[model samples]
Target chain A: MTATVHRLRKAAPSLDPMLALVAGDMNAVNAVILDRMQSQIPLIPELAGHLIAGGGKRMRPMLTLASARLIGYTGTRHHRLAAAVEFIHTATLLHDDVVDGSDLRRGRRTANIIWGNPASVLVGDFLFSRSFELMVEDGSLKVLKILSNASAVIAEGEVNQLTAARRVDLGEDRYLDIIGAKTAALFAAACRIAAVVAERPEAEETALDAYGRNLGIAFQLVDDAIDYVSDAGTMGKDAGDDFREGKMTLPVILAHARGTPEERQFWKDAVEGRRDSDADFAHAVELVQRSRAVDDTLARARHYGQRAIDAIAGFPDGAAKAAMVEAVEFAVARAY
Target chain B: MTATVHRLRKAAPSLDPMLALVAGDMNAVNAVILDRMQSQIPLIPELAGHLIAGGGKRMRPMLTLASARLIGYTGTRHHRLAAAVEFIHTATLLHDDVVDGSDLRRGRRTANIIWGNPASVLVGDFLFSRSFELMVEDGSLKVLKILSNASAVIAEGEVNQLTAARRVDLGEDRYLDIIGAKTAALFAAACRIAAVVAERPEAEETALDAYGRNLGIAFQLVDDAIDYVSDAGTMGKDAGDDFREGKMTLPVILAHARGTPEERQFWKDAVEGRRDSDADFAHAVELVQRSRAVDDTLARARHYGQRAIDAIAGFPDGAAKAAMVEAVEFAVARAY
Candidate 1:
């Protein structure tokens, strides 16, 4: 590992503290997740369990739980809402695997690989529907509106990404917009709804939304950077997957913007799926490094990370508030 | 058409009068549909319009409208709810086409065929999320609960069907369970929600649900039987699509049960996907006919049709009630 990576590993706030703080609520959220995933069709549970039971970070639901507690929510509805958040995230992952034709997720065979694309897609739908049910049971139209709108935005982002994929000319603004819709929108909603359920004022709701939105952006930026820097084992997917899939993430877009004419042609060929050998990947990585794309990507992530911290600064100092602020830092640090 | 079909068509009450009865409300529903489908991304509206703008019977949404009118509702929330119902149905159709590898729907090329599977799946998700947004906007927790639960059940039924696909030994009860989850559940929810939004008594809600549930069962039964007896032109989808996909619809299941040893082997080969030629389809049809599977399936459908009519007998006589009764008869008559 690089010195930066070593420093990141040491300096980043451990999620263990946050997880410990919310252990009871997180436990309840997990129970709700397990209970809601059951269906009369055995395969529904079987396929869904394979994905949901896999040891994902549970970061989104953790955000919901942490945000709810940060705002002093004492009700059990946040547990259901957290579960709903996770279900929506899980559902998207299942569909994303199908869309990307991925064979593995979180170091296990993807559900699509095990059950085929049809089952994955349908099960994803089931999880999504189940998420709405949980939201309804929460009995807050404001919460429902936030999460439901986020769902639509997420789908819109996926479709927008599809349109932008393999296009060398994609701009950074468009890339940011795509990530905002696909990833940050849910995070924003997850945090905003915590305030809604707590009956917090609109200002707090907006502040929490801002915090989550910036954190989500930072998270995705780091994820994209990690793809360029990390190996298959560390990334939990094949190295250079975004490149192979023609995804126009930040590093590629930045590299393309900074490349010479021949280098630009190289990126265009790679993104259009004309270049896909190990040697080609190596050359692409070298070009990206030569253009300092990863460094630039991380800098952008840090910018968002700082904004996330700023967004939550008005909240009273507490364990939940401190962990949430640290989460933004950790999101950026993960790239190193 | 056969003589029996001709006679059935003549005796069946026309839906045109029903359609005309709620034409204004349906027009409002369509406006909501058109408005919600719009997105700045451009491809979303384009792809969704291709499917939604293509003509469909709009049966489920009509039930929402009719049921609301049946319960003497004067509010406009049902219009939004009806649009939400159509969005859910359309979303399912998009995903279903991908799952079934279907190229045609409603006598036109399917969205997946025009745009790849990824676009279709993502857009379908967009529509689903949009559906939830509409439900949330309606601001009725009961409406949200009914629709959300139906969505989950529909997905569960789809997964069940996936598990049961190509299995020659699928039982009648299992088939009923599958259809109940996938098709009838939504129908039941759509009608029940009309009562909910109208604030009708629980008994009336139960009655409307029963009416929709039986109507949906009869509708699907006729659909399955039509696949065996009708041509592609009449069926919209290619004839024998279920057989080609090795779907264990009621006809195939019953035929498998009643076949001779040799005939059973034929079904086994066909259902196991070892038979897919024109000659195989012809022979499979012959076996189904010899075993009287279509006749039996239609008989069962008629029984459900009668029950659907019986379910709504307590409603006061009116044009809406008359139209709904005709809908049940119309559902069964289509198979003839």
Candidate 2:
């Protein structure tokens, strides 16, 4: 493992009991997950397998499994829910590539680029249906309700982002709402739903939901910040890629909000007018840094991360709780 | 009213009960639907409105309300579900216009032609999200489960249709499966879910579901046949529109399956490739008639219609039951 991987692992709590639970005593849950994730069409399986194997951190699915384990779930529904979460994430990624018109994702050609937009779209639908089919096997109405609402929120967030693209008038609250809808809602749903499926007490369910929501918010904010400041090679794309694509990320919006008339004019002409060249992109990056937008963005992410940790404070200091806390800290501290 | 309208009124039963149920006694449902369906953006709302108001007979939403009532539902959730069904159908129409590159729908310009593809696609997403938001208001896990599955199936069916387009090997079973997934699944869900939410007995629910499935199959078959035989004004838009677009409707597929070598070659060239003028279209229409393909197609539709009526056989004979039977008969008998 790389140093980053080593660091993340060291920080992770050793929840042996939870791990044992997920291992299904004979690794049956893992087998079920693997068997169910396969697509009927070889190409869909291949494309999805590539993404699943591409080191996604597996934060959402892990939460689902961990939440179920923490709540003392005995049946195999958690396994199905975990697999459902992963499928939902993968489906969103397929659609996201089309919406972003992206070529590379995680240092590889996007599925849209490799398999064509129609294939990506159709396969994405297949995954979505496959998810419902899996969840139905679990026969848990709570899981269905949570996941369905999450999908709708995610789609709405995408639409809102599309409408907000290239517009510099986006404020901090709007950014929060957009990202919350797009990213955090599903993350929260993933963990919250695991608890719901396990039939946990209402208080524990509420605490876990708050923790997941805050953690997800922090994760997205950090991602936005990294998009403006991370190394192109390490990040698998250019820094300020969002700005180049005319996305009004938090840093750019903040920087523009605080810019002088001349600076604002430059942005109006460049960002909104499709000025996606190296020079224009570099200028935008410089402006964001000069304005200290990166610092403010990081601070906001840290605030959310702290709140994430705070959310789990009501629980006993067990290994699962500690691991959840550490995950939030690592999310805020990590570099791309 | 015209003779056709008068006949339709006689055949359509008293839709007032279903309409009133969908609109609710308070009348807020219609206002909400009108408000949500109205577009503030330029040209999009106009085109969408034109199609939305195109005297569509509101068949899908009516099915939802009628099924819910048949199951003894007393809640307002059915109204919201009805609205959601309409939104989904409208969204599909928007996407279908782009995929078919259609200029007119129900004798009016399609949304794609009026608002461009990008706008139509994005707004289609909007309507999709709106549908989910509407469904979410009911907070019924059963309803969410049914709708989510239906949405996924619809997307899959669209993808399958896209793949099957421009191919001559598209057989009858594949065609039926495609239409079943794309169109009938939602209708089936609309009817069955009402029974589900009302907590009816499984047998009754299954019956309503079968009624919807058979009705949808019959509805699509007759609609496809009318593309060849009906007047442009009566059917809305010009006749032979599907042929001009190279769509392989039931009549064409039937004719091709039973044709001689010369007729088969003509089918392959005209339906699969080599775009032709008005003369070629005329010749193709003549061939379809000479082969008696339309008769076979209508017979198949009637078979499904009979099954639809048979599905509701156990229900105590009442106006609603009679109306459903008459509706099926009218749907199949219209073109003839």
Candidate 3:
């Protein structure tokens, strides 16, 4: 379902290869996720399951599993650690919904909308605490340190984003810093911990971290690009949602940077919540297209995508390596 | 400033002894707190400082230090751990304010009111994550497990309390369960971790756990009683806050159980948010007084307070022991 031409295969790049590589490990991770999320308070699981069982791709945990396979670590410790990573991700999503007052995610009602913000907040806290418990059970202070630091960075990035909200002047450097912390930090930690569990050396740990970090940036750039490009519908996101919310995504940054003075004024109005009508969004699309902002955004995604693939190039060639490469390809190719 | 008579000296019970015992260590813990709450993002430290620097009693961290002192472990490790405990407590308070939609706490505007719910929610997440980071830095998996489990239990209790909100039929057993998880779990964990860090035996850990747990319950029971007995204002809590919010505390539970049919209906209306007028609260207080509900609640507090003191009876008799006993007395004596 991807559009990028593979130089060697002439076929579309897809995540199927990575999914196949980690299917068994993924099952183990899923089981741990379902098992640990249950609580004596029924609302805890009910609210959590709505999102956990919701039909989003288990992208973060899959990275953990895939990274384990790439390193040829055949132990089962990543199963629990992968589940912990997913729990952190799920907790972040639940809290994000509350913070944004988001009613829908991935074509489903958010937990906050269904269960109310208080439940969402508390259950999110539950999952977060549970994630740490799982890490402690794994008995790796190193892993605990990594994940906990990622969590703090994610919170910091969220606060940064919150404070920077609706400001058209939030240039690319600050925007990238925001996404690096909020999105890439966990992906990096998720992959890095696999190395830690495998007893891999610092070099491998750092390489895997780079791989996940770069892929995460690419993934987020595409997601942000999708918000401005209505026809990018293969991904289940509803375009213009960010526009309506006046979110300052990279495309908005690029479009504002490259626009005429009048166009920059229009962009500022849109970001500041004044212009959100369909016609306004349509004009926004026209302006971004005229300035090639979406094109450059995807170009930036591909740049990071290439870095991700190269980060793992030193690993021995095998199905795992090929799938990992194709996964980055698939990530960057989605916006096409 | 406390009313309870000490058997040994015929003097009033007070926290001054305990406060004096931990004064030096508390400064070190405070230093750690001030150092760690900083962030590159200005708003994080800005919002967190407003509450952390705001005049909180630092009771949870003080418990950690006091427990360490009682065990005669002269290490300074509890300084950082105690700060971590205080962070966990502050995070909980921030989220609690958001959950309760409370505008004031400790007679000052809450973080949610001064900033907003979004800031409070994110900063709470930051502090929670930061607390785990602190625990991880301490490099004790045992401590991590205790604090992590306590954190999860606190979230579960919060969800339980939310679901049980505005329900007059919430009996004593369920109310105890709720408070046990919400309030006592952290207290137990805070005190228990001191033993873990001191390398004390399991028996000491369990004893400290019981001491803190029972004291937490007694502390809460008296706070609930104070809500009904508005003239009991030495605790700095604005009494009758729970009544207006339709909170079903122990005082309401006992009063409803002892009320006549008409009085029960009034309580039903009060707990369900129908009866919140000043005259209604006055009549409600009169009913609770005639039923002796507040008196019995304080009696229950004394029961737990005695249990708390007895739990640590095996520890050596020293200033720490006397201070700990008087602290319990000071807690349960507040309602009188």
Candidate 4:
């Protein structure tokens, strides 16, 4: 192993087993996701297939498989669970693009832009329903409960974020709460369910859930941080896109708090009003950088990344745990 | 009993027993719906509440309660189930308004009009998730399976509708399939679930499902028929509005098939193009009326209504069963 992997393995040995299982079956999980997303409606299936095949990191599904492996599951149910996770995530993305009026997603034209908001929203709902159907096949009420709750929390968080936009008072705590609901809740549920389906001990299940939640927080924090610094190609979105949209990400929240009076006033006006020009975006980015918001936000992400590693302290030594630790570190550590 | 209570009791003896359990308690269900629907965002909750209280017939929930009673259910779970059904229906309406870009609904401004599409879409997601959460609380994996599957089918049907828009060739078979998924599937599932929850005989469960399915189909057919004939207040919307939107209701479809070459081309350009003005709408309505499309469509609806009554043939003669039968007949009996 490379020095980075070696260090991660030494720090969190439990990740090794999970990584082995995930790497071994990544292709199979992808196949399952594709197969189940197909609809009897010819146009729907074709459109959904094209969107699903478009490159995505598939990070949420990885959590499901990894958690199951960590809990010593040998059944194929994890594969179904992984696919379900992907479907739910994809459904949310389709709806999100429509709601956000976004033309681009993951460095490509969004489904809503191609088909129309009506198609995307309805198809997104289709995926959500289909995901539940997949979970039902497992016959686990606990799994359904976890997922259903997570789905509700995710929706609530998105609504919260909508209200949070352009508000000067959005703080770190609310930010964490928003990200937890919007992003981490599903990740946590994805991992927790992996353990639950395997019938692991409650302690281990809780540990895996914590790990997932912390990892998700780290992922989103870094995402927000990168929104200020990275280009469209690297970040899979335009730079300062959130600023233009008046979204109150962690970096912007921090920057606003630490800015001078004039800077704060600029942010308030910029966020509340539409900022469509390059100069407007550049101004937001400059102010964020000047206030050290990016650095502070990166520090917060690293903190959560470390918390993720700490959450899995009790798992047995393995490659899965190690990779998970490495992945969390990589998420926030990279400049991009 | 008061006259209304006596009338209800006379019509549906089985429903009398169930109403004894649920009538006074429906407020709790409504409260649950309202509480769960509240968002941190002012616009979302404000608009959602207005629409939720917008004089809906609330047939889905009543069907849920009646079905559970028919199956001898004694548990409080039916209330939760009823609320979930209503939430799902409401969520769909919210999204549908946005999809149709409708300014008016039920003779009032639509949620999308008052709150904007973003809030409507996101809040719709909120209600969808809330419905799932309620289903989870029922602790029946079987119920979750039924509800989620129905939800997915509903969404798929919507996507199919979106793609089929403005297509003059959308036939009866395809229309039936779409409505089955979009409308009847949930109605069928709602009844089926009551049987499942009450642990009724398999045959009885099947019968209840058939009853709901036929009833729902009839209900939709009547709704479509009324679109061409009923006035705004009586039908709860303007007359012949479907023509303005280019929606091919059953009457329109029947008339189109029976129209002369000139009439066919007129409909093809006007309704399908969604470019119909008052004159065009008047002409189309007049043509449909003269072609006997309204009568023909009503005959089709009555056929399903009869089938709905037939599906309940096995049930013992009781007030509830009779009322249920009346409900089906009433669905298509008159415009109101």
What TM-score would each prediction reach against the true structure? 0.95, 0.83, 0.97, 0.93
Poorest 10 consecutive residues by lDDT, candidate 3 chain A: A1-10
Task: Rank by DockQ, highest first.
Answer: 3, 1, 4, 2
Q: Name the candidate that leads on TM-score.
A: 3
What TM-score does chain B alone reach in each candidate, compared with the true chain B?
0.95, 0.89, 0.96, 0.90
lDDT of 3 by residue, B1-336 (tens): 443433322257789999999999999999999999999999988999989988887989989999999999899888999999999999999999999999987778998998899999999999999999999889999999999999999999999999999989899999999999999999999899999999999999999999999999999998899988878667667778889999999889988999889999999999889999999989988988998999999889888998888889888878998898989988888776
DockQ of 2: 0.26
What digit string (tens of lDDT, one per residue) describes model 1 on residues A1-336?
Answer: 222111122475766667877899989999999999998789988999999889888888888889988988899889999999999999999999999898978779999999999999999999999999998888889888999999999999999999998999999999999999999999998888889889899999999999889989989998888877745344465668777776788999999999999999999998899988788888888987889998999999988888888888777777887778667766787656
Residue A314, candidate 3: alpha-carbon lDDT: 77
* DockQ: the better of candidates 2 and 3: 3
lDDT of 4: 0.79
lDDT of 4 at A35: 82
Docking class of 4: medium
Q: What is the interface RMSD of each candidate, in Å?
A: 0.5, 4.1, 0.5, 1.4
Candidate 2 lDDT over A241-309, as tens digits, reads 677777777887788889999888777666586577888877877888899888788788878877777
- Report the number of the highest-lDDT candidate: 3
lDDT of 3 by residue, A167-249 (tens): 99999999999999999999999999999999999999999999999999999999999888878666677989999899999
Question: lDDT (0-100) at residue A86 of candidate 3?
Answer: 94
Output DockQ, candidate 4: 0.66
- The TM-score obtained for chain B of candidate 3 when compared with the true chain B: 0.96
User: Which docking category, incorrect, acceptable, medium or high, applies to candidate 2?
Assistant: acceptable
Separate clash counts for every candidate: 1, 0, 0, 21
Model 4 fnat? 0.75
